[model samples]
Target: MTPDAAQAWLEKNFAPWVLALSPRVTGIGPGGAVLEIPVTDAVARVGGIVCGQALATLADTAMVLACAGELGEFVPVATTNLETRFLTAARGQAVRCEARVIRAGRALIFAEARLSSLPEDKPVAAASATFFRP
Candidate 1:
């Protein structure tokens, strides 16, 4: 899907809280998607570092977009499993998530995501997820 359509899909489909993160779809193509979320106070913890929950949410959302790109359209899919590993604290910088579909089966989809701090490009988190297409 095109970037504009991806952005519109996100805005229309995601929850208000998820949309509150202000995720922007920068790129999208078959099997891959890239999204950026600003590091604002809403997503920061007491230390001003981006929280794990927000990171995970971003990863999950990016992977969903990747799945949509792979399928060439947005379809409802449930996350069967999601794993996230935090590598560093994301402070004072926007976060970018790059997600790609690892495999797409008839009833399942496997994807992985890497999140990094912008400009510095320092790794912040890595995530893998499985989605059930019903």
Candidate 2:
């Protein structure tokens, strides 16, 4: 899907709380998608580091876009499982999530996402997601 359509989808389909993260679809192409979540104080916990929940949302959201790219359009899919690994802390800027659809099949899609600090591109988190067509 085009970036504009992806952004519209992100705005229309997700919950209000999810929208609060201010997800922006930077790119959507052949096998994957790129999403950026601005690091706002709202997403931070006690410390300044962006929280894991925000990263998880980024992973899940990016995977959906990646799956859409693989399918050539958007469809209803729910995340069945998400395995997240926090590699480092992200602070002071947006976090970028790059998601690739590892496998897309009749019933399920498997995706992997890497979260990194924006501009610097320092790896911050990784996630593998399982999405079931529903």
Candidate 3:
């Protein structure tokens, strides 16, 4: 889907709390999506580092879009499982996530994602997840 369509889908489809992340789809492909997440003080932990939970949210949400993009439509999918590894503290005000669909089938789909603080050019977290249409 186009970036504009993706943004509209995010606003209309996600729950209120998830919508508050202020995700903007920067790019999308058949099996990938790039999203920018706003990092405010509210989402940051002590020492001004963005919290892991916030990054995980970004990763999970991005994977959903990545899978839908591969399918050429936006459809409801449940995240069955997500595993995240925090690499380093991200100290920026904006972070980006790149999610790629590792494999997609009739039932379950697997994806991997990377999170990084923008302009810092270093990864802060990595995630893998499974999703299924429900």
Candidate 4:
């Protein structure tokens, strides 16, 4: 899918709270997508670090877009499993996630995502997810 279509899909399909993160689809190509979320107060914890939940959400959302790009269109899919690992704290910087489809079978899709703190480009988190196409 094109970047503009991906952005519109995100805005129309995601939940309100997920959209509140202000995720922007920077790029989308075959089997992969790039998304960015600003590190605003809404996503920060008491210590000013971006929370794990928000990062995980971004990862999952990015992966979904990656799947759409892989399929060449949007289709209903459900997350069967999602694993996230926090490598470092993201403080006061926007987060960027690069997600790609690792494998796509008839019924399942495997994907992975890496998130980095923008500007500095420090690795912040990684994620892998399984999605079931029903």
Candidate 5:
């Protein structure tokens, strides 16, 4: 799908909580997508740290949309497994979640995502997920 189409899907199909996190779709391609979430009081937990749960949810949501882009349209899918690892805390600035499809099969898809802060070489969190495509 075209970048515009991906952006439109991000705006339309993402969950209300995900949308409230204010993620912006920066790029979309056959196997990868980039999403940026601005740091705000609402998205952060106590002490102004970005919540790990939000990061995980963003990763999963972005990967689903990326898979949809690669398929050229939306397909109903359910998460079968999701594993998230928090490497560090995100304190300031926006965090970027980059998701890539590892593989896609007839009934399942595998994906990975990295969440990092701007100019940081290390990821704050990483996630691997499997989705049951229907």
Candidate 6:
């Protein structure tokens, strides 16, 4: 999907709380999307570190965007399941989320993402999610 289409989808489909997380759609291409979530005090848990719940929510949202991008528009999908592994703490910088669809079938889609504070290959959080597509 195009970047503008993705941005519209994010604005229309995401939950209010998720939107309140202040995730910005940085880039969108077929089968992939990049989102940046700024770390704020409200999103941080203890010691000024980004919360795991926020990371997981971002991951799930990114996956949905990826699947929608791959489909070349928005398709209503629900999160069937999501698994997240938090590897490190995200401090001051905005966390970037890169998500892509690994495989998509008629009824289900598999997607994965990495949340990182750096541009390097390392990820602070890794997530895999399954979606029930409409």
Cα RMSD, each candidate: 0.8, 0.9, 0.9, 0.8, 1.5, 1.5
What is the C-alpha lDDT profile of model 4 across 1-97, one tens digit per residue?
Answer: 6899999999999999999999999999989999999999999998889999999999999999999999999987899999999998987579999
Candidate order (lDDT)? 1, 4, 2, 3, 6, 5
Query: Lowest lDDT 10-mer window, candidate 3?
Result: 14-23
The TM-score values for the models, in the order shown, are: 0.97, 0.96, 0.96, 0.97, 0.91, 0.93
Model 5, position 98, has a per-residue lDDT of 90
Clashing pairs in 1: none
> Each model's C-alpha lDDT?
0.96, 0.92, 0.90, 0.95, 0.83, 0.87
Indicate the worst ten consecutive residues by lDDT in candidate 4.
Answer: 87-96
Query: What TM-score does candidate 5 reach?
Result: 0.91
| Residue 134 lDDT in candidate 5 | 67
Q: Total backbone clashes of model 2? A: 0
Question: Largest lDDT belongs to which candidate?
Answer: 1
Residues 1-134, candidate 6: write the lDDT tens digits. Answer: 56677877798888899999988888887888999888888898878788999999999988889988888878899899999999988776688999999999999999999999744535789999999986
**Any residue pairs clashing in model 2, and if so which?**
none
Q: lDDT by residue for model 1 over 20-124, one digit each (tens)?
A: 999999999999999999999999988889999999999999999999999999999999999999998987679999999999998999999999998799998
Q: How many Å off is the CA of 124 in candidate 4?
A: 0.5
Cα deviation at 92, candidate 5, in Å, is 2.1
TM-score of candidate 4 against the unseen true structure: 0.97
Off by over 4 Å in 1: none
- lDDT, residue 46, candidate 6: 76
* lDDT tens digits, residue span 1-134, model 2: 69999999889988999999999999998789999989888998777799999999999999999999999888889999999999989876899999999998899999999999977999999999999997
- Residue 127 in candidate 4 has what lDDT? 100
